[model samples]
Target: MKYFVTVQATQADYEAMEGTESPGPPRWSREELLAMVNFMGELNNELAASGELLDAQGFTAPAEARFVTASPGTEPVITDRPYAAADVQPAGYWLLECVDLDRVTEIAARITQCPTPPGSPEHPVVIRPIGEAPAP
Candidate 1:
């Protein structure tokens, strides 16, 4: 079965940011960021070798977000401004074809080892099963 595993962050952290997007990258050193990137690459390689990795990627900064809200019998309200940072946002995700949820949970746990801002150790990952489409 296919699963979606993504890094999740709290609204509080985003609210504390100087910007809505990527937090400006000023929170970590270049070397530290490079190390995290390398670590992610290693994890992706492992998944690829296992033939479980369907896709893996990070989302663009939240600053580019667009909101479309429509009420009953009303035209949709569209806005390009960043949506509420109080809501949890996905930072990135890995799409994997795993045998079951247990394996997917393991993968998410491993992903927790990825470094975050200094003194902050609460970045979490969420995993959800991608169900099949309805038959025609």
Candidate 2:
């Protein structure tokens, strides 16, 4: 089965990574950031070798996000601003094809162990099964 494992973060988290002063956690040192990058690369390689990783991607900061809302007959409303920092946003995701829920859950557990600066919040890692599409 296929699953999407998502990692959440707040605006403050993004700011911390950028070495900016936001109401979030303390900034990450350059070495810490490099460690995180390396960690993720290693994890991805391991998953790919096992033929479990289908895809993975990280998102930009929430502040750079664009929002759009519309109804069938109404014009689309658009804005550049994102919700408040307290609201958690999806920071990245991994698409995986695993043997079963247990396997995917194991992968998610590993994802939750990804490196972060000390004292940083333990962000959530959500796993959702992908449903089959209806035949056209």
Q: Pick the candidate with the highest lDDT.
A: 2
Residue-wise C-alpha lDDT for candidate 1, range 48-121, written one tens digit per residue: 99999999997665656678999899999999875554456787899999999999998888998986556653
Which regions in candidate 1 have their CA more than 4 angstroms from the true location? 10-26, 71-74, 83-87, 134-136
lDDT tens per residue, model 2, 19-122: 88665687998898898889889999999999999999999988889989999999999999767877789999999999999999988898888788778988
lDDT of each: 0.75, 0.89
**Which residue runs does candidate 2 get wrong by more than 4 Å?**
none
- Candidate 1's error at 104, in angstroms? 1.0
Instruction: Give the CA lDDT, 0 to 100, for residue 54 in model 1.
Output: 97
lDDT of 2 at 104: 93
